[model samples]
Target: MNTTFGGKPHVLILGGGSVGLTTASELRKTLGTEVAITIVDPRPYMTYAPFLPEVGAGSIDPRNVLAPLRKILPGTKVVTGGVSAIRSADNTVVVTTEDGAQLEIAYDYLVVGLGAVPRLLPIPGLAENAIGFKQVEEAITVRDKILANLAEAASTKDPKVRKRLLTFTYIGGGFAGGEAVTEAEDMVRDALRYYPDLHASDIRFVLIDAAPFVFPELTEDQRAYVLNQLRERGIEVKLETFLNSAENGVIKTSDGDEFETDLLVWNAGVKPNPILMDEESSDLPVVTERGPLMGKLDTLADLRVNGAEGPIDNVFAGGDCAAVPDLASGEGKFCPPNAQHATRQGKRIADNVARSVQGRPLVDYYHKNLGVMATLGMYKGVGRLMLGDKEIDVRGLPAWAMARAYHVYAMPTLGRKAAVLAGWASNLVSRRDIIGIPQSADPRAAFELAANSGPKKK
Candidate 1:
């Protein structure tokens, strides 16, 4: 590490997700005016993904949940680009800009916070038919698509067309799938007012999962309550059934059940960005076939990538992307890929990186599972909380409150949090704004053409 204040050591951070911003804040706190930091990510802003469901349901403006990285990281330089490769040997990173230009950046230290991408499963026509929930754009697209489908259903005279347009399928039983179903259901319920012909009964909402139960984190009693709530509302919960195929509007489940659906949401799971798995960086630890092991042995103390000893010196990694060992589980287990784990990983990695710079002993990652929570439309929900040896079950308003409260704090900045609050307050009394903004590849092309054809006075 460079020990000169006039020529401070350069710190380069890849990816501007939740982990990246948190790491930058902590690093700035420790390094002070001693080190220069630069962050690179494709998007200019960091999105609070917990609010993505709200955006998808049109309960909040998509803009309210995203915080600009440039505004947040004032002292640090923010580069709007994606890191194509990380070369640990020379302590350099190659990045590709939005316009397809490439540049090499050298760093004294590298923090690889490259976050998870939506896991696309191998299902027939899934690529063309299903939408994955990961970004703010996907959420916005979901909002527009659902509303358009409802409008189409209301106006169409053909029974087959109307049925196909109204049927919605969500594949996955985790928080993303559960929350999305609830939010979308609430929006569809509210939208019924605008459609004179379409009743709440006409809209079919189905939640499918390969797992036997919904919300795997919840206790048996709480799980039962969640299932009952969905059933009471006439929402179909298909457990142990996977999505066999979804071609256009046609959907077939693994259990021979078939339906034609307008919307197919694949919230199944998430995998680390595949770019990192390439053979370019031999510094990265060999992961197991299931993408679990960080090193040869699953339980590597101190979060160090195995093979090469001594912290990999310059390069560091954490969050969902890396397999950090969980001490709570005595077995050789990695932490679950969730917001709680990701947030904690950010802190530990930052502290460890700082310790490495100072030539101090590094600490291992160790945390107990805190259970989970899920919202099931409006006031209905279910959850389990692990406090010491006691485990408490919660449902209804408590679960709803937990879901909202956790995410409110999770949202990036003060401005975004306030805007989200305002959106919630307004949504209680008003209907959703369901206008569609069709995306065009050449967004400014029309304007340019119009300017050229316009009558001009010389």
Candidate 2:
């Protein structure tokens, strides 16, 4: 570790999601040449998760939702790799690059913003069939898969095959699942106009959740309104139900209902990044509680890692991977793993780290919940905003506009915001892009086929 005060302190940040990216940007702006920062993540860009639903529905281009890390953080070093192990005791981390080479990076300060991964259940055939909705790539895949299914279903004369292709089943009816299914249904409805054989009534959209209600973030009235709106659009909301199995395109539910679905979307939930729980990272204290937040790094209100004895020296953590205290929510409550909290926590932790480095006092992170918003479809949505002690409920077009405007303002860069707006504007003036590029899933298949087709001509 470079302990010399005369040289710039090396700060190593894990993950390049909203939290990590925000921290690096803020630190670079504040400390300038006083600190050297390095960020390590598997992806080269940060996906604006809030726009993922729109991306999946073709409302926004996939590239617009992603902000390249290196471009945004000009002064920082961005390493595209996955952290294999974190030996924090010695201030070293082993990162496995894409090419299978490993590099050991040492730092004077460490930031844990590794983010979370999809929490998949062990239902039968889920691993082989289900698609996730966490990243930009996943969103693009979902969009393509839906379009492909719709095209295939339109051409198929077999009733069973058509039904299977048209049926889209989504598990877990939280904000992610609810918004995704609704937007997808809207896309399918819009696309059906071009397919003479397909009708709105022929499509089946099922949203199944173990909970009795969806969108737990919304109030009772808002939830009811959202549910009613969905049902009015011919969507099946199976509450208090669980997916028993999804084998061979057959969906078996806890209610004993079985159906076939070619598109199975799994938006169940998310857990902290597995790196925090890996045996190699045993040195870091992790939450052992059996819940959604299990395996997260145990962190104090100041965003410092809580070791067995006390706060770990020169180490801090925030974002989805860290169990940060929700100071505004009273005692024993940790911040939820959402983009809002993650982004705010990132800025706070960055300031605290800078303060600690400059021998100044560290500040604790505290922010009140700003409520939640979800766009049901085009020109339709619901939202609940917290204004002091009072709550304001919004629905329909205004809510949709508010959601879009807020996301645009919150998006990291002006370039990305403009791109997203351009995409939306282009969609307004033109028809929705229903064409699916099936070759994207396997780009090399055509090349490989041609290569194996007999010997080269003399």
Candidate 3:
């Protein structure tokens, strides 16, 4: 390995998300001062994505879902920047810091965990109007938007305006969309108790998906059960449907359904970071085929980048950005880009990197998925746990409990876990807080207006 400074191998990680955070933590713990570690990301904090649904529903505080990178990884260097280009041939990466300063950092080893972004379509007004649900801020916006709409609908005497404000349309029915729509619906239901003028029937939730069913990960019976539960809550489940246009608050669907919605959430899917596919930005070998796993870094089971013949030297990648082979499922199968795989792959890659530094044989990553779980509102959920070769299906309260337990265990720090648990416990005894700080979206607006106001003459 090339040593750039202090005669120690400098490991540069290109993301501060699940994989990056785990890898950095483990490397610091295992290698100590033997290696110099640096993590570069646009955000200084790592957002725990699984609890985003609860955060959107006001069940969890947004702060509880974020762990600061600097505080968590004390010994490692944290750079708040976005990578513009990866010049692996020169052993340097070009990064643009938050303040727009460019830097070229040299590293002996490179770890790619840049993760994915929303796979948006070219539908009309989609980019301008649709809200995303990927990060903690987006989750907070979703919560605030829903609450703000409800409050506005309650005061509006115009029936058409009220109907439009109360209608919330969600596109895509995957795990993220399914949980998000359901949880948002629950919040509206709970908040209706406070508004005597608004009833449950006044609010409308429409979930649209291009597929025939939502939660394809669930079994046939389980999927049916989820659909039934959602319909029972008065949420219109429109499967085999697509959003044709979302122009000017009017939603036009492929099924010829037209409606006006105040809020539109796009959670269809995600693609690997654009830098991985762009030739100018990255020279890495990425799968460019037109498929579900397209535009991902071609990686091996040992978490090393795939070269023309074999693994590349000192270049490792895992997480949503890499097409890692699913060794446990045999050949021709790749691991799904999910948090469950990303977190485990992080630990594996860290150990393998340490082994490479010590001149030891590296180990392959293989782990059977433990289960699939989704929460529907507070105490309702669905889960499928893998017990050996058999599958155990669970729903309702037990599944909800299991989902919470799993997330608490999966969350990075004990402090964050305790905070999340405290929020959930408090909600059990008190009513859900329906107050929306819409001003948070533009916190400086009021101050800016005051500053522009002309001084009054005495």
Task: Please tell me which predicted candidate would have the highest TM-score against the true structure.
Answer: 3
Residue 291, candidate 2: Cα error in Å is 2.6
Between candidates 1 and 3, which one is better according to lDDT? 3
Ranking by TM-score: 3, 2, 1
For residues 132-203, could you state the per-residue lDDT of candidate 2 as single tens digits?
A: 999888889888988998899888899989998889999989999899999989998889888998989889
lDDT of 3 by residue, 141-229 (tens): 98998899889989999999999999999998999999999999998888888999998889999999999999988999999999999
Show model 2 residue runs off by greater than 4 Å.
Answer: 1-6, 448-458
Better of 1 and 2 by TM-score: 2
Question: How many residue pairs of model 1 clash at the backbone?
Answer: 0
TM-score of model number 1: 0.91
What is the model-wide C-alpha lDDT for candidate 3?
0.93
How high is the CA lDDT of each candidate model?
Answer: 0.78, 0.90, 0.93
Pairs with backbone N, CA or C atoms under 3 Å apart (clashes), candidate 3: none
> Which stretches of candidate 3 lie above 4 Å from their native place?
1-3, 448-458
